[model samples]
Target chain A: MEEFEPKIVAFCCHFCAYSAADLAGSMRLQYAPNIRIVEMPCSGTIDHRVLLKALEDGADGVFVAGCMEGDCHFLKGNYRAKRRVSHVKDLLRAIGLEPERLEMYNLSAAMGPRFAEIANEMTARVKGLGPSPFRKQTGGDA
Target chain B: MIVAEQKPLAEIAGMIGDCRKVLFAGCAGCVTVCLSGGEKETEVMATALRMKRQLEGNPLETVTYTATRQCDPEYVDAMADVVKGVDAVVSLACGVGPQYLAARYPDLWVIPAQNTTFAGGSKEHGVWEEFCGLCGQCVLHLTGGICPVIRCSKSILNGPCGGSQYGKCEIGKDVECAWHLIYERLKRLDRLDLMRQYREPKDWSKARDGGPRKVTREDVMIG
Candidate 1:
């Protein structure tokens, strides 16, 4: 049987995580291929509904990558994103989903290697959790 | 504003037991500002319910609608067409919202998705504090706009009692003694004399004591 390669969606902030991803690409950093990046205006704009929709639409794992704490381009955007991410985590847990399936990461534009590391880390974590129960039920895209 | 919070998803999900489809009705009134019920919340809740049921392999279907004010019949009436064919209506408004829905739709099973907490406003972003007990009486003038009936731990009309310490209620350090706030506020206004006026025992009949209260404004009635 082919082992489960979990599908991961990363909501990346343009100011930081998006730039970091670009840098990682420039540096030719190799990471897990299962992760898809959705560049957001700011992580603060990542809505709770959008995050849940990602999971419900069949993504095995979701993460919001924002600027470092107290270092958001919009001053408190990252802080807001952090609170929202935590709230969504609670929502995920309330629905019997493994809360670990979602995460919030803080990275700077300079953190190319860190971006690659996060992709690999998230991929491995989701792989460990296996295809999400939603995926297993519907045989959704892995 | 009436402040409220969403009930746990598990509890909400439990309310619809075995129902394959449901309509989530959200209010754009107080519950909206408090972020418990609104268009977005309605969508989010419906999505959550669908996903939960999907995971269980039952796959619940959902319809979403946001009323301008669920407490008002006109808005509740707006849910009329949308409520058809659904096994239940999950009202995301405050407690009053579900009651109104139930009253509007006889035979429709209406469930409340939020726990209506208090008559209050936001303290800050994401924080709401109860400020009024809705005792059906106004005492804000005497209390210097600080409601002793609700904010005071004992609801003492003439208080601060001996339980007040360092401006905090005996109940908790975080609870500001409502009477203390009243005293300070009145003192600042140079009306400390009002504090000693010897408030008579409040008339209980004017409040909830006589059962559910109503104000019939005859002037607003149309022939």
Candidate 2:
């Protein structure tokens, strides 16, 4: 059997995490290639549907990367995102999926190294968890 | 407005057992404002059901439709096209939605996905408390706008029932004694004298004891 390569979807706020990813690339950081970063206006804009859609479309894991606590460009966008992420986690668990498959992180735009670190960390965690049950049931690829 | 809560996913799944296709009908009325049933909840339910059934090796197809107001026959009639093909309909609206859908499509099976909890409004985001007992009477004027029929555990007309202590009801510490609240409010409004007036028993004829009720306005009737 081929080694499992998890597909991870990372929703990054444009004001922070997305910029951090760009900075990570500019700084020659080597992060996990498995992370697929999706840019949004703000982490708060990442709706529950978008997260669930990522999983339904074969993502092994999904995470939202937002601005550091109390530092959101929109004041409370990151806080709202935190609450929404928690709600989605509960929904995921109710559907029999591993709640750990989804996560939320906060970091500043200048934290390029942390961005790469999170990508690698999330990728490793998802790899350990293997493919999502939805992927397994649908006979999807690794 | 009516407040409702979605039934457990497991119970809903069991109710839809062996059905290959189901329609999830959502209401854009009170349930939407209450966050119980609406377009978002309907989609969430469909996704959850599809995921659950797929994992069990019995893939289920789900269609989602949201009516303007499920309690109205005209709005429910709008779903005729979509309702034709589904094996069953799982209404995410309050109890009224399923009954209306069932009435509209007599041949199709309609089931409720929510427990019609009460008529109330949200005290805050994601929290709702019962406010009306649907007793077919309005006594808020006499009670200083506080409803004792539903808010009070015992529905005492003249009470802080003997079990009331610290303004809380005996039934639960979390529940405030409704009569006490009414008294305080009336006191503040300088209508405390209303509390002393001997209250007559509530007339049950106007309530559910009279069976299913209807409100008609002859002036608004169409030819």
Candidate 3:
């Protein structure tokens, strides 16, 4: 049987993480293909519900990749995203979910290597955790 | 407007524990202004529920919808499509919205996300207090705009009770003595005589004690 590969959703900031992924493509950086990228004008546009929908849709893990601290193209966008991510973590934990499933990272658009690095890191972390129980195949539906 | 406070998250989570397909219904009315329920909150709750279910190995199906005013029938009717296949409806409006939903959708299980508090205004950002006691009597003008009925811990109409000291109430030092506020305002207006006027004891019969209140404006009636 093939080992379960975790599905991960990455919200990439248009100004940074998205561009960094593009840069990674140009650099031919080999990384895990398990991560799906959703491009947003800014991390601030990543609402709490979107994150929840991804998890409900069976994503094993979620991440927000935004500009480095104090460097958001839309000033303070990353900061706002950080706060929202933390709040979501609390809400998740309160509901019996591992807060670690949701994460926020700050990096510049030029950091292609970092993007691959995080992609590899998250994929491994999720793999160790096994498949998401929410997946339709897991018999998790009530 | 009807005001409300968000129900504790733990409590809400427990209520929806067995639900799979759920509709998070939020009201864009008083609860929205108070930050208890709104479009953003509706989404937040749906996400939380989804994540929780996934973690528990009992994944849930959740959707979010916001009504213009859940207390209104027409607005609530808009949720028909969203609630179509859901097993339950979690309402984020005040006390009125859940009752309205339950009444309209007798077949659907309805739950409340907020605890109806009172008819009040936000004293400041994120802080709300009871302002109108719904006494059915307007006495604010006589008290220099400070409502003694709701602000005063004792609801004393004559003046500040002996418990007042240094401009605070005895019930709690942090509480600003409502009558002290009245006195200061009256003094500023140089209307000290207003406090000297003897007022009769309140008639509770005409207030909320009379049962569910009703107000009819003849001129405003279409018929």
Best by TM-score: 1
Question: Could you tell me the lDDT of residue B50 within candidate 3?
Answer: 70
lDDT of 1 by residue, A57-114 (tens): 7789999999998899999888888888898888777777888889999999999999
**In model 1, what lDDT does residue B140 have?**
92
iRMSD per model?
A: 1.1, 1.5, 2.1
In Å, residue B208's CA in model 3 sits off its true spot by: 2.0
Task: Give the per-residue lDDT digits (tens) of candidate 3, residues B68-143.
Answer: 9987788988878888988899999998998999988889899999889998888887678788888888789889
- Model 2: DockQ score: 0.53
Candidates in order have lDDT scores of 0.89, 0.89, 0.87
Error of 2 at B167 (Å): 2.4
Model 1 Cα lDDT, one tens digit per residue, B1-223 = 9999889899999999779889999989999999989999899889888887887778899999999999888888877799999999999999998899888899899999998898999889889999988887788999899998889978889887999989998989998999988999999999988898888888777778878888899999879
Error of 3 at B169 (Å): 4.8
lDDT of 2 by residue, A1-142 (tens): 9877888989999999999999999999999988988999999887877787788767899999999999999898899889988987887777677888899999999999999999999989999998877665555544
Candidate 2's fnat? 0.30
**What are the runs in model 2 whose C-alpha is more than 4 Å off?**
A136-142
Q: Pick the candidate with the highest DockQ.
A: 1
Better of 1 and 2 by DockQ: 1
Total backbone clashes of model 3? 0
TM-score of candidate 1 on Cα atoms, chains taken together:
0.96
User: Which window of 10 residues has the lowest lDDT sum in candidate 3 chain A?
Assistant: A133-142
Error of 1 at B217 (Å): 1.7
